[model samples]
Target: MDKKEDKHKVAEEPMEHTLDCMSRLETMSDEEWNEFFSDKNSMSDCSFLLGYKEAKLRKEAIKPNAEKAWQHFHTSYIVPETTRRHMGIWIYPLATIAAILAIVFILKFVHLNSSDIDVSRPFMAFTADHAPQLITITEDGSRPNIIEGRQQRDGILINDKEADFTHASFAKKMIRSIATPRGKSYKIILNDGTMVLLNAESKLIFPTSFVGKQRNVRLIGEAYFKVKHDTAHPFIVQTEKVNTRVLGTEFNLRAYPTSDTHVTLISGSVIVCNRSNNKAIKLCPGQDATLLGNKDFDITTVDTDYYVQWKDGYFYFDDLPLVEVMKELGRWYNVDIEICDNSLLSYRLHFIAERQASIDQVVENLNGFSYLSATRQGQKIIISKKMHLKSD
Candidate 1:
């Protein structure tokens, strides 16, 4: 045969092989399927033969049994082969299963094309690790002596060095501050046994070890506090505009630089006092106090879950304004959100989503319930109203 004819015949071989394999699969009993998959060379040959384009199966709808076959093969036939000679048997099953899954996935993609897949709500499609938590500065205007942490079952575990409180060196009172940049969070146990969950873009400054009568710390961002009760020595969280005093209680404090400061009491009574005016307000469980930019305090009843959900690795928005929602998303995703229209800010949305979910997934969920659209350009996410198509 001539070169052109031989080339055509070679091209047709893969297609013919694919058809033959499919025909065999149609009549393959459980024992035969196992036998076919049990052989390494045959499995490899099947994989090469079933290449998507060569099979000419892209245009065909996935067979109803494809999913069932995949499930059965995945759970039963894909097992480890003891002999080294058949090691490829173990690997080839996975490749064949992946090829089968691709077909099912392609069918779903084709089916969804007719359904609504909102393009305006673009998702990031990629995942990113949480930003690193760092010790920016320490008391005495120096850096931390040592900073170390590791992932644990509960969360990231921060290591703390024990200080000799009784020694004369401790009399000097050393303060240490740890900060988590945008897109990361950390949990640290203070020297006093108080546990603090610091949210992204937040900082906590406390002594290397508690000393004297008062256990005090200054906060520059948001944190959930589980203070260790010391009746004789009160725990104080000093913010930019307010100070929260607690003997023993669970509460969440938010004091972002550009936003109003808030203290939400979860389980105990605490006093939130304004720094400038020394005006103090006692908050009960489920109560929240907001310190406005003007230093005016607004006390109201609130669901504490909405405030402390970040510690639990979720963003829980309950009738929260669109602007506020975007602000929170921007912080956790480490992106800039620009709202093109001010009216969108008035729209309220309520949803609960994992903090680690990609920005695209969040935007998709958001667009599903609201008339909003988000587009990303570099690190900025632009929000606007979704355009409606008129029906003829």
Candidate 2:
């Protein structure tokens, strides 16, 4: 019979018998499975069996009969060569049986464990090993109250702790602060439902409640904002060099003191105003506006993915200068990167790496390039150009 006819014949067999064979295969020993796979002659048979099992599975949503899928495996895959020749029963190759068994096992495992998955957890690109601090700033400049894991009804939550601002004594003290140190990032939801993801070495200060017409927050480093829609109470973010005002929008604001202020809009709309000069410019989605000292805004259309991927758990670089790439890595890893040679700074590269990866893994990937060399010493990363040996 041809391959089609063979598959149909197997499918026509009693479902109980097919299931029994699977149960036995699940119980087979590792040595027996290795022996079947090692037999080169049985390769085709294994493929055929695998295809048959997949077809049957697609036709019916049948669950495996075994509790522990692997425990039910058996050694009925092959009979001795002499016993098969003497008996009338057709001998099926062990390799095919093993392949079929693997498919059924995987299906069963998935089916049984599906309910254990958590669906409500939010996805984050990276989490700092060190926790950020939450403090309430008083007008008197007294020692700030350091808040940790606690939650209060109708108040803000920091880490796990919640601050009760409803009390009369603390209600007047509206200023609250969240500070993220090097190698750490923090996330918080303001009273107005605005979600902010604070980047490393960043500080955000805002009122405990939105009592005024404008909801204002001051930012120091880098942060991603998802402002809640409130036309009456417009949201405003004050950076060192610029102020971003938005009704309801998602955007990333990079205002590190050492770098130029950048506002990259992801959705809705925003107006960026230079702090030095009140000149303002409107930005639409997929556009980046940078404030250059006291000059007018420099607006440019950019790939939004490159700016916002940091919050989603990745370091995305698209033909960026190697020096800029190292600078970003330094912020999240809490390390200083020193370029021993200036020639390597001009080299542009496109790279993507998981934010949670270790610094060692990052260095290893950088060294993979033939012309670049990277090494880690204590908490510092040293970069240098690779010297190639001339072939005579």
TM-scores of the models, in the given order?
A: 0.60, 0.61
Candidate 1, 339: how far from true, in Å? 1.5
RMSD of each: 21.0, 22.9
lDDT of 2 by residue, 87-148 (tens): 23324443344345454654466455322222222211122334443333232345665545
lDDT tens digits by residue: candidate 1, 1-392: 99978976786676566445555654677667667667776555545554534344444534344445434432332222211211333434333554543333333455432112222332222223344534343446675543544322222234532222222235455766777767778776776778888888888887767778999999999999999989999999998889999999999999887677889999989998998989898999999998765468899999878999888899999987676787788878877676664335456778899998998888777777646877777667777777651110
Model 2 residue 116 lDDT score: 28
The alpha-carbon deviation from the true structure for residue 297 of candidate 2, after best TM-score superposition, in angstroms, is: 1.5
C-alpha lDDT of candidate 1 relative to the true structure: 0.68
Q: Which ranges of candidate 1 are over 4 A from the true structure?
A: 1-139, 143-172, 389-392
In order of listing, the candidates' clash counts read 2, 19
lDDT of 2: 0.67
